[model samples]
Target: MCWCGIAVSQILAVRVDLWNNGNLVQDIFLGEIKVPVKVLRNDSFQAWYLLQPRENGNKSSKTDDLGSLRLNICYTEDCVLPSEYYTSLRNLLLKSSDVQPVSASAAYILSEVCRDKYDAVLPLVRLFLHHHKLVPFVAAVAELDLKDTQEANTIFRGNSLATRCVDEMMKIVGKHYLKVTLKPVIDEICESPKPCEIDPIKLREGDNVEINMENLRYYVDKVFREIVRSSISCPTLMCDVFYSLRHLAAKRFPNDPHVQYSAVSSFVFLRFFAVAVVSPHTFHLRPHHPDAQTSRTLTLISKAIQTLGSWGSLTKSKLSSFKETFMCEFFKTFQEEKFTESVKKFLDDVSSTESKEPSGVSEPVHLKEGEMYKRAQGRTRIGKKNFKKRWFCLTSREFTYHKQQDKEPIFTIPIKNILAVEKLDESSFNKKNMFQVLHGEKPLYIQANNCVEASEWIEALCRVTRCNQKRLSFYHPSAFLNGNWLCCKATTESTEGCARCTADVPADTQIEIDGDRETERIYSLFTINRSKLQKLEEACGSIAVYQGPRKEPDDYSNFTIEDSVATFHTLQQIIDIVEKLNESHEKYQKKRSSSAKYGSEENPIVGKVS
Candidate 1:
């Protein structure tokens, strides 16, 4: 009989023991059968049976056939097999229709067989999804969908297949489907734009849309939980998803206070999440880029500060707390010098333009002397009988001087009538003996025979004056020698020209006269003592005299020569010296206190310095 003509029962019972080197690997059995009698008629005709190992004796259902097959044949001991046989066997095992005894084992087998040929499996999974009501089949299809998304995405870029699979899964499991579907979507969204169309109306009507505070809160909480559960190893992707969701939440429930509050709250949690996820070693990475997650975190903080600052009713305590939180976080991140440039740019972008000065406060002004005019000087009438003209002049030291120019004793002299008025330096009045010719304790007098002689005498007296005095009196020769004298006394108290003296004189009292044929004769005269003049000069230089009446006797008496000179230093220089001393003293005190407080060997001065 030919090999092809052999009956099923006539096939040989084939048994094979397989080994690697000397180790016994496996034993496999082929069905009992017989070898054909006429098989040798064909040159290539050989009766052979191949035996393959099964997992658990259930040959039809096993997934992995680990052991090699053995063959019962009439050929030589070392027969060569064609490679096509192994290829055909693999193809047969992989076909879903050929898998018998349907079980998880068979499913495992099918998964492995079709692992590389996803296109081939796609058709069968589609068939199962169409015809099967089995939950396992649905789960299997969902797994297949997840596994094939990248391929499906590439194949159907703008179509509905990708979204359809997700929608079906979600419908089957409700909210729980998120646990299965979110990760793939997160990855996809991060990698590319939303591939599937989202129904804006449906999303708006969803549980997240409820304006009630509690419902919104619940929705936000759920979304946060989902995000937290996702594997966000890729921070860039994580950040993209975060910002997308935040953008959605913000758009959908913009007017909802609770939604706004929850969105900001979620942002805060996300920041902390990034901080926790980033390793200390890699913490400094991408600080400038800061991913979308960190940007959202900073933006939310800024918004909170702005909202509180703007809200008229926000309490001071709440505002303070908000500021404190923002400042603390800002400073912590900003302390790093590497971030300074970027931080400054961000601050400039977000900072308010209006000045921070408080409302209702006036701007400060600087006053100067030229802004106002000086007051005119006025005089008081003296005694009930007469009014004296007096004016005030400002001295270089800023002191005011009251003077009656006409009352100056020198104004009444014959020289005053003879000489033209001359403007002298103001310092001329400050000379030691200038005022002594007018008034002093010891007065000088000259006796002249006539007005021409007196004019000549007055000019000589003015030239020889050497001390500042309170008054000077002029005497006529006849009046002085006969004891009937006309004396003109200079007084600062005079309201008019030096108290005028009119005295009748004896004609015969011709005091000693110097001979000058063309000029008037000279007369007897008295001079102030030389020692008294010297004393007066010393007193004038040492004392600071005021033109006003004395209020206290000791005011002038107690002043020392040195005190006046010392008082003339600039106020600023004095203050600077005092400040330097104070600073040095304070520094010393601080050093001593610090040393005592720490009492370390490095600070040995703690006890010894004090």
Candidate 2:
């Protein structure tokens, strides 16, 4: 048999002939076969073939099967097809499991057509679910289109099929793709309907916005549960999900105290903090993993901490209570001693930093209530024979000493009762770092690491305790007294050092206060101006915008020009401040006038004003 190929601009035809044993017993001319220029479905053309009897002298009417032909036409390039045809092809592929693998191009076309059609995407996804092993289906669901991920997450976040596919994909493709694609869509669907305002003052408006608190609660709980479920099974995805959820919560409900409270409460309820405290290894770096994965997870954990930390500010005492609670629960469940120690250390460190202070300040200026600062190692006199090394911690409230890093303080000195700190006989102990903390009933002789540290400690302590009553009228001038230096500058050289050299305690220590008053003044002004501007913008419903010179021209003259644009709101802010100041003055004048007219109410016998 002979076959001939004919080509045209748009179509190619393959003409076939049939032969029996090469005798040309029958010449069968097949119908014209058009080579597909583009394909809408998996098949390029319909399958068509025929067998015929020889036209020789025998002339038997019964046809003999010589040959049959089948063809599959598909498109590599983009080709539009009806959704029905793509659906049909997908169904056929799913039904024909034993047949050749599903056509990649057909799946691609189906996804491309159904990318935007939610109605069509779900059914396609379901079809792919049955044939996910096929590259075409996998690509359609995960790689080729995002609509599948969105639809799956939106419509069926908890659906078994979709979640299973996602779990598998996360393992196969890693957490990055899930974060960039799937997690956002899920978060969008689960986002709180109430529009969150960045400023707390603006959040007052959201109270009237009508939100379903139950829905918000359910959303947070659901996301938290999913992350917890994946803690062991899908650690990488769990890390990403946790970070994403915390970020969304913090960013969206930054100013909403109730929402922030709810988030913290939810984390506690769901045992999220418990998991974190116990299995930080899962969230943070794994030394055995590659650098990239380690870095990614480490960054994610850090961000998660930051986001959670922003949810609410906890005081040092409250944080200690939380640490105690977490440790209690953590030990109850895991009971790993090593992890317990590490977690306690971590908690101590984090809890110690409960308050965030401004950088570059040498002293803890903004000390929170019960916040410990300036903790260091020092030697305390135990008896005349020995000095014990101890860790000293200073707080606005008290001074404490601890035997170990993670232990509770064994000694405490209240700041309110401490009267004064005096420089001791630095030369007597073969050291220049001795100081005495004079408080109730006795003076405690403490040896610091160096002279500078001793000076700083004494200055800090004196500044905090200068208002207290003097505890001791005079130094005792003795060698030993209740594990303290009773000797006032008494040394071996001098039999009575107190008599030989009188202690000249300064009226004020060398420590300076009211530091950088100019900077503070400028900051206060800026703060006041900012508040006034915000008020003006709120009243006027317009924010001032500054338009600078165009950067494209790069004109040298623009740099020298003094120009700025301000709105009516700018003038309005100044007017508002002036009005407030004037109102204060008027009120002050009215108060004086009333007081003068009323004479002296406190003293009823006083004469009336003339």
Give the top-scoring candidate (lDDT).
Answer: 2
**TM-score of structure candidate 2:** 0.20
lDDT of 2 by residue, 118-180 (tens): 323344333433233323343223222223333221222332322333333333323332233
Clashes found in each candidate (C-alpha, N, C closer than 3 A): 20, 1
Alpha-carbon shift of residue 286 in model 2 (angstroms): 53
Q: Candidate 1: list runs displaced more than 4 Å.
A: 1-110, 115-122, 134-610
Candidate 2 local lDDT, residue 391: 66
How far is 351's C-alpha from truth in model 1 (Å)? Answer: 52
Residue 601 shift from truth in candidate 2, angstroms: 71
